[model samples]
Target: MSFLAKIFRRRPRPKLDLSHPQVVALSARLRALHAMPISSKEEVAAWEVEAEKLRERLYEDYKEVYDSLPHEIEHYLVDVDIRAKDPGYAKYQAEQLVELLSLPEEMPNQSPEPMPLKRHGSS
Candidate 1:
């Protein structure tokens, strides 16, 4: 790989941060525990114990990244104003409901010849 390409390469998003094989297995179990339907108080107690162990392990593994996150810019919001003139095909009056609305002069249809509508009031 070129030096510039290596430097500019994008890093993949972090999923799990634990180092040990047993701890990684425990982490998957912890996630499965959250998804499972537990009925008894004993099950709940066991879940809480597993969760606390996982939490401690994760904090130890990624302490620097976790601590620095609060100081870093966390959220981003961008406001944009979009002004669009209605394309005018969406609605029509009850009196002229029988007649089809012609496409706008700015936008021509696929038809070879567009027959202009004769208004009731206009000449």
Candidate 2:
């Protein structure tokens, strides 16, 4: 959530996804880092922090997919099968993000009034 979201309004928090590979890989990497030496405390700390961030981002992506996954999303991707989890999930997520980004331009209040149309020889 952003400062603006806090002050104005906030969208619902997304659900956690345990199955995404990025989530699984980052968790494994974090565990490995923990098992290694802590001598270079700063470097280790930095990597640990980065892994946490990746985890959060993957969770957010999954949440967005869960929120608005359309049936058409399955058929939409070329050379990809919806039965395959990641491919299906990504199509819906990408579509959702595109819709959100395009909304501002669609708001009636944000658009200028249309020019009046004239009929030929009309008073």
For residues 57-117, what per-residue lDDT tens digits would candidate 1 score against the true structure? 6556545444422211111000000001111321122112211122233223343243342
Candidate topping lDDT:
2
User: How does candidate 1 score on lDDT?
Assistant: 0.34
Q: Write model 2 residue lDDT over 1-123, tens digit each, in one string.
A: 889878999466454333445434433543343233323445445544654554455445444344433333223222122212353453343343332222233424333333232221234
Give per-candidate clash totals.
0, 0
Report lDDT (Cα) of residue 63, candidate 1: 55
Q: Candidate 2: lDDT over CA atoms? A: 0.38
| 10 residues in a row with least lDDT, candidate 2 | 74-83
How large an RMSD does model 1 have? 24.8
Off by over 4 Å in 1: 1-30, 68-123
lDDT of 1 at 50: 55
What TM-score does each of the candidates earn? 0.28, 0.27
